[model samples]
Target chain A: MNRYIKLVNFEISRFIKLYFVLIAITVISQVTGTIMISSQYVNSASEAIYQHGVSIEQFITERGLMSMFQVTASLWFLGPIALCIAALIFYTFFIWYRDWFAKNTFIYRLLMLPTARINIYLAKATSIFLLVLGLVALQLFLIPLLSTILKWIVPVDLRLDMSVTELIDSFFYLQIILPQSFVEFLIYYGIGFMVVFIVFTAILFERSFRLKGILLGGVYGILSIAIFTMPFFIFIDYLYPIELLAVETVLGLIVAAMSIWVSHYLLTKKVMV
Target chain B: MIEIKEITKKFGRKKVLNGVSFTAEKGEITCIIGVNGVGKTTILNAIMNLTPVNSGQILINGEKIHKGSYENVTFIPDAMTMLPQMTISQAMEFMQDFYNTWNQKRASEILGFFKLKESDRISELSKGNKAKVNLLLGLAMDVDFILMDEPFSGIDIFSREQIAEVFTSHLIEDRGVIITTHEIGDIEHLIDKVVLLDQGVVLKEFNSEEMRETEGKSVVDVMREVFKA
Candidate 1:
């Protein structure tokens, strides 16, 4: 168990620098974006009301604060969110491949460790999980900071102060990131873990068999997705919405188990350093 | 005792190790010598279970080798096994963390003997120093057996001498070592047994001393005869 922790920490150390860069990119782009858009709204409103001799009430009523919020979310937040997701997905494969493709074959050392080989797999998975959660937590903290930036740029009278929850509910992606309830959060992140595991298993397949493994990995990935969602398609019409979710969750767990099992077998029996 | 019995391996349709078998007991150094493209490295990998074997068993002390069996063994491949970004100290700590058999005192001694500083990053080290670090990682472990694959393949003469010095040192005294190398000159005197491989088969397995005294032939002489035919 302690060895697994060390393995996890070792894995995390490899990518922690890149992770920080990702965070910095997210923080800089999103904050700058919020400030720029809010400043633009304030300047445009001032021009309409004062320079053009229009009423402040008419200006405020015409461009609703809700519209300002929507614009800010769409223009700035979405890009960073998408970028984070894409980077993480790329890293899921990179974490495994980097060890093999690096100047030194770090995979050899990892495979020869005096613990169960499954610990290596679990540790890498845990590190990816921790990274995703860390970024999620960072993004969650940024929401309030961004809201403050919006409040600072736009005057009190012109601003509509919405709670963080309200802001999250307003956007589709935000809702996915910061789900309404704990169960929803678990379900979302569980799926994320499943995706990471499936990709990891695919990479193991590729590594073990070389060119043939590439084809095998792709097929394995598709099969994993199918298995995870099999319950949904099979009982879509017969089951209630809640029952469907329950069955889907059960199937998802089974798929996760299978993915880990296949990965363990490959690592132990087939993988070559 | 380490017993590899009739191990067979293939990559695609090409057979790499065809029914290869050998044994290395504790307190002896076994050298697997063969030309390039032979199954030298693959044999070590198969022993460590780093690569799959199609048929046969690798037994350590009468039991089939398993994941937990690594506690008794360590492997140093031809290439650097540590991450390039890691400093010597970090790499040592990583080994210490994973293997309970890790001996920090011995590791530090080797570091001092090799004149490798703790702050040195693996990527910054020369090819020879990288090889030293790889050797240090394996030698520091208090295991019964150590497997080295082409440790002297690419390095300066000075580094090769330094690495060869390790063979005579007390560092490897009682351990069963299986080293794969075509260059047999460096540790020729240190090898107790030699297994000559060619075309995925073990052509001959003989005691080095017996070859020297009775057979009146050097490993190179035996190799010339084996490959000539």
Candidate 2:
């Protein structure tokens, strides 16, 4: 357990420099975006009421109140979020590959760590998991700051004051990230965790077998996806909606368990440095 | 003892190791000598479980090798295992973090012996210094068996001599050492046993002293005769 945490910490340390850079990008891009969009909304509102001979009521009805939903919709806001997501996805594979491809091949040290090889696999996955959650937490914390930015740019009557929940509800992506209910959060992140494990196992397959392993890993990954979605296709006619969800959940768990077992086998018996 | 019981390893269809077997006992130096592509490094990797074998078993002290075996057995590959960006001190700290067998005092001692500063990044070191650091990391571990893959392969004469001097130094301290090298002229006097391999097979395994005493042959002379035959 202790070794696993240290391994995770070690992995985190390797990526921390880039991680902080990612955070900085997210902050700068999103805040700049919010201010820009909010300023545009307020300027248009002023122009319409003051110059175009429309009442504030007409301006409100025509342009709508400046809200975080509108502010969050801009490319400035979504682009950074997309970039963060893409970066995390790229890192999911790079985390494992970096050790093997490093100047001196740190895989040898990691594999020869005198602990169960599964600890290394788990620690890597855990590091990715922690980093992903860390970014998500950052986004959640950034929402209010975004709201504050919108407030600072637009006049009070021209903007809508939203609670954190209302802002999240207004944004479809935010709902997916920090789901409204605990169960929904579990279901969303649970499938995410399983897919990450499957992808990690696939990478190990490539590392172990090289060219032939790529085919093997691809087939393994496709099979996992097929199994997870099987209930929607095969049992849709017979199972209730709740029953189908339960089936999907069970299959997701099974896939996760299989990936871990295969990963453990590969790490211990088949992994190549 | 670190015993390899007839291990076979295949890279795709090509057999890199064809049922090769050997043993290295504690307090002795076993040298595996072969030309390049003869599976010398593969054999060492198998012993350390750096790569898996298609068949047979590896045992350290009469137990089947596993992750725990690393505490007692360590491998120093032909290249450094630490990241190039890491300083020597950070690499040592990394070892200390992962291995209970890490000896910081001995690590410091070997660093000083190599005349290397701890603050030097591995990437900045010359090939000879890098090889010394590679060997230093393994030797500093209080392991019973150390497997080195060609510690003298690309080193300068002075570096080779310094590394050869290590075989006779107290820093070795009775650990069983299995080193693979294509050239043995420089350290012929230091090896206790030699396992001569050709094309994935062990051509000969003998005590170096016995070869000199009984056959009146140096390690290289035996290699020439065996390969010629």
Candidate 3:
């Protein structure tokens, strides 16, 4: 347990700087987006009412408030979020490859560490999990903060004033990230966690077998995806919706366990630096 | 004692190591001397399980090597193993975190001996300083066997001299060491046994003193006869 925690902390420290940069980018871009849209709304409203003698209600009806939904829709707002997600996904693979490709062959040291090689694998997987969770939590926290900025600029009559949950339900991607119920959250993120592990295992396979392992890893990944969705195709006619979800969750867990086992085998027996 | 028996390793279609076997006893230094690409580093990596072998077994103290058993052995590769972003202190802490056999006091002593500051970042260090840090990480570990691959390769003469001093120092006293190097002049006298390798095969394994007294031939003399290079 101590060794595992040490590995986790070590992995976290390696990417902490970049993680902070990701957060900074998200916050800055999102804030700038909110301010820009809010200023535009206010400017257009003032121009029409003062210059052309239009009513405030008409301006309010025409241009919506700087709500979370509105903030999320703009390219300035969504662009950074998209970049953050893409970067994190890229990092999932880069974290493992960096050790081998970086100067000085850090993989040799990591592989030779006196712990079970599985600890290294688990630690890396856990770090990615923590990073994703941290970023999500930050996004959740920022919604309210960015909402406050919107409220300050836009009048209450013009503002929509929707809660964070309502804004999440408004968008498909947001709903996927911020599920309404605990079970939904688990089902969604559980499959995500499984994907991270599968990718990690695939990387290990490639590292172990080189070019041949690349094809093998791709096959293994496809198999993992197929296995997770098997319950849907195989039991949809026989099972209820609740039962189907339960079965899918169980399958996801199974795939995660299998990926971990295969990763351990590759790390211990086949992986070379 | 450490024993490697019939270890074979292949990278793609090329056989890097084939039917290699050797031993390094306690309180002795075993050196694998060969030309570049002769499987010298691969042999050490196999012993540490850094690179998986295709066949055969490695025994430490008469038991097959297993997970969590690497504490008894340490490998100082030619490349820097610690993350380049890490400070010397953090790297030490990292070693301490993973290896139960890491000796903090010995690590501190080695730091002082090498004149390496704990705050020094690995990325900013000179090549010689980086090599010293690598040696420090290995020697500080309280292990029975130390496997080093080309520790003296591509360094200034001063750095080579400093690393050579480590062999005679109490840091490695009473510990079995297996080292591989193409440049053998630096450690020729310090090594107890020399294992001559050529293209993944062990050409000769003999005690240094016995080879010199009985055969009246130094390691270089044998290398010339073995490879005719």
Candidate 4:
């Protein structure tokens, strides 16, 4: 377990340096956009309440309602997309440089370590999970900060008409509900993808004499995806009842289990030094 | 403490090891001398269970070695086969974390002996230094047997001499060192037994004193005469 942790720590330390740059960019863009948009909302709210003689409570409710949908809808798209791209890049870095890293003196040194191979695999998985989780958390924070800044910048009269608590409540609810579910879903998805990728590469490496492993892995991965998705595609037309969440969950679990088992078998038996 | 019996391996249709049989006693250096492509490395790998032999029984300390018995053996392949990406320290740390037999003090001493910097990545080192580090790690492991495939192939003459001395001084007293190499001149004095291989078979096996007295020549000279014959 300690060995696994060390491996995880090593991976995270290395990755954070690369990922922080992207985070910085995200922070700047989100903060700027929030400030700009909030100012507009404030002006619009003030004009509607004071100039048009609209009731303060109704104006506040209206603006809060609008902000709820707008903020959530934007985050619903941006958060997951940003996280997925970052996660892909992180995992891809490992795939791309595996051979170079695998054959290095460092790995030779590492191979001699008294740790189990499973620990190494788990370490990588944990690092990837943490990275994805961190990105999601950052995005979640951004949504609220954006909402607050927008409320502050809006005209004073408009601010009086709106219920800041109600506006924040909606944002928080969407932030928790969507991002939490999305992160969980992606965790499973990412692990499945990683298992398949690792196994394919390991098998290809064992079969070939050169660096053809990556190419063969890509080909194998595509074939596996096709095979795995065939059942879903075939049954797609009859999937209208929508309450078969239990069935869907069970099937997903089975597929993930099978993929993991296959990867474990290939990695243990087929991989060569 | 290691035994190989009737082992044969093939790459495609080309037979590499053909019914090769040998035993390596504890606390001795066994040199498997052969021409290139004669299954020297294959035999070592087979003993380590790194490669599957088509037909054979490899027993380490009376237990058969397979995928499960990997913990009992440590393999030091040719210098070229060493992982090139790890820094000396990172490699040591990894080894320390994995193997029960990892001796950090011994490894540290060896690292200090070679003056290997902690931050110097393996790929950044010269070929000889890389070999030195490889040998250092193999020697530090507290295993029953150490199988080295061409440990000195690409190393320099001076470094080879230093490595030979290190092998003799540190290795020969307590553990088995099985080495396969074409260059037997430098290691001639260090080896206690010689297993001469030709075309995938063990042609001869003789101890150092017996071979010297009977043949009136060193292992290198005997190799030349045997292969010539």
Candidate 5:
């Protein structure tokens, strides 16, 4: 456990130190966008409702503005996807250049380290997870700052009675706000992302084969999803009264889990260089 | 002590290793000499559990080493290219954190012996110095068996001599070492047993003294005749 902690800490610290400038740029963009949008909403609230024939209170309640703020504060799903892309691009270039520079270095040497392979995998995954989470936290911090700034510009009547502490509490809850039915869905999504990379890396390790593993894994992943859901789709046409969202969510989770599990098994057991 | 029993590895139709077997006793150096594509490095990979074998098993100190038992082994390959962005000290710190058997004091001594400064980034070091660092890390591990695949392939003569001394004086004591290399002149005096391989088969297994006395030939000469090189 101590070794695992040290390994994860090492990875996280290295990533933050190496990419602080990029992270700072992302945060600055997010903060600027959040402040601009919130100020616009505050300024146009009265006009939007009375002149535009839109009931502000009803629209806000129905659309769940509070929940939307929380979700947007966490950068929604798009934030994680963006972060993943950035990480993938950075690591891809970094790994490629490093391997090219040191042609004779084998992956077997890394496997010989006196720690569990699973721990190494987990450390890297955790670094990605925490980096995304840290960016979300930064976005959340800007909400209160934006709110305070808007209050000075606009009258007090237009501003909602939301405090930074309240906003933080809501944001914290939003972090785990998924329903029990969707919990597995989110978990599987995260695992599926991890597996895609694991398979890609395993293939790379096999012979330093370029992008074949990733490409193959992607094809396999899509095939697996199709195979898993095609039967359900066929059956669902007959059982027209079924709860489609619930059934789809459950099936998606199962398929994602199976794909990730298979990917990891193949990576650990069959990978060679 | 390390023992490899009847190991076979096949990639589809091509047999990389075919029912090969050997053993290394404690406090002795076992050298594996083979032509290119003869599975010398494959054997090391199999023993280290870096690659799975199609058949047979590997044991260290009479205990089986396999997928679930990977922690009991250590291996140093021919050449390593670490993250070029890392300094020597940073890499050492990473090794110290990851390996339970890492000896910081010995690692420091070796760094000093090689005249490698802590602040030097891996990219700044020459290929020979990089190879020396790889050797030093392998030696610093308190493992029962150290498997090195072509340890001196890209190193300079002076660094090779320094590494050879480190291997003879401090690395091989109450622990088994298996080195695969073509450069026999640097390590011939240190090796106790020699295993000759050709095309995935063991052609000969002889003790160093026995080969010298009976054949009146050095290991290099024997290899030259065996491979017809």
Candidate 6:
């Protein structure tokens, strides 16, 4: 267990540089985005009330108060969020492949470690989990700060003050990041976790068998997704909503277990350095 | 004792190791000698379980090798295994973090002996120095057996001499070692045992000094006699 944590830290340290860059990109792009979007909204409001001879009430009724939702809706805002999502997705595969294909084969050292090989797999998974959580946490902290920036630019009458939760509720992706409840958080992230393992097992399949394994790995991934969602299609009309959630959770755990088992077997019996 | 019993391995359809077997007892330096691509590194990788075997078993101290086997054995592959961004000290810290077998005293000694700076990043080191660091990491471990694959390959003559000098010193004393190298002349006098391999099979295994005494043939002569035939 101690080794597991150390391995996780080691894995984190390897990518921490690129991770910092990712964080910096998010901060720069999003903050810049908030300032620009708010200034534009205020400029438009000014144009309506002062230049066009419209009443303040008319302008406010016409355009509504500038909330964080509008800022979040723009390409300036959504672009970085999309970029972060894409970056995290790309890292899921890069985390594994980087060790194998680096200047020196770090996978050799990892494989030859004195602890269970599963620790290596689990550590990499845990690192990815922590990275996703870290970015979410950053966004959580950034939301209030960004709202403050919006308030500084847009006048009180021209803007609507929103709590972080209210802001998140209005945006589709933020709700996914910061789920409304603990159970929802587990359900969403649990499926994400299983997909990460499925892909890991697929990678192991490829590592074990090379060319033929690539085909085998793709089939395995598709098959895992098929198994996880089978209950949804088969029992869609038969089960209650709560019962279906329970069934889906159980099925997801089973798929994750199977992936971990296959990964263990390959690492022990079939994988080559 | 480390035993390789009739181990066979195949890559796709080509046989890499065919019923190749040998044993190395503690406190002896055993050299696996063969021309390039004759399953030398494959055998070492098999013993360490870095790669799987098609059939047969490898035993350490009369038990099959497993995950825990790494605590008592270390494999120093030809290339550097430490990440390039890490300084030499950071790499040492990594090893010390993972393995209970790590010996800091010996590690420091080797660091000094090889003239490697603790602050030098692994990526910046010369090939010879990188190889030294690779060897240093393995040798600093207090394991019972050490497997090295072509440690001397691609090294400068002076560096190779320095590494050969290490074998003769007390650093590797009383430990089982299985080293594979095609360049036999460098450590010919240092190794105590020899396993001559060709075409994925062991042609001969003998005590080097005994062969030198009774058959009056050096390692090269024995290799010439076995491989040529």
What is the lDDT of every predicted structure here? 0.87, 0.89, 0.89, 0.66, 0.66, 0.90
Share of true Cα-Cα contacts across chains kept by each model: 0.96, 0.91, 0.89, 0.25, 0.49, 0.91
TM-score of chain A of 2: 0.95
Model 6, TM vs. native: 0.97
lDDT by residue (B1-229, candidate 6, tens digit) is 9999999999988998999888999999999998867499899888888899999999999988877888899999987898998899999999998889999999999998999999999999999999999999999999999999998999899999999988988889799999999969879899999998888999999999999999899999988989999
Write one digit per residue (lDDT tens) for candidate 2, span A1-273: 389989999889999999999999999999988988888888888788889889988889888887888867788888888998899899999998988887788888888888999998898889989998999899889999899878888989988899989888888888888888887888999999999999999999998888999999999999999999988888899998888878888999999999999999988888888
Q: Any runs in candidate 2 off by more than 4 Å, and if so which?
A: none
**Which runs of model 5 end up more than 4 angstroms from their true locations?**
A31-106, A147-220, A223-264, B11-13, B67-71
Instruction: Rank by DockQ, highest first.
Output: 6, 2, 1, 3, 5, 4
Q: Return the interface RMSD of the candidates, in order shown, one decimal each.
A: 1.1, 0.9, 1.2, 4.5, 3.1, 0.8
What local lDDT score does residue B69 receive in model 6, on the 0 to 100 scale? 87
Candidate 6's residue-wise lDDT over A91-189, tens digit each? 899888888888899889999998889889999999999998998889888888899999999989888999988988888887888898899899999
Q: Estimate, for each residue in A1-273, the C-alpha lDDT of model 5 and write its tens digit.
A: 576688678667756764576566655655555556555665466566777877866646643342225324646333643664577456533442333345545345455655655555556656665665565455456556656655565455444556654554555434442212345436544444544454434443433223555666556656656755674768676654446545665665676466446545553565555
Best by lDDT: 6
Model 5 steric clash pairs: none
Output the better candidate (1/5) by TM-score.
1
Model 1: per-residue Cα lDDT at residue A250: 88
Q: Give the number of the best model, judged by DockQ.
A: 6
Per-candidate chain B TM: 0.97, 0.97, 0.96, 0.92, 0.90, 0.98
- The residue ranges of model 3 lying beyond 4 angstroms of the native Cα positions read A64-66
Model 1 per-residue lDDT at B143: 92
Better of 2 and 4 by DockQ: 2
Each candidate structure's TM-score, on Cα atoms with residue i matched to residue i, is 0.97, 0.97, 0.97, 0.74, 0.74, 0.97
What count of clashes does model 2 give? 0
Q: Against the true structure, candidate 4 has what lDDT?
A: 0.66
lDDT of candidate model 2 versus the reference: 0.89
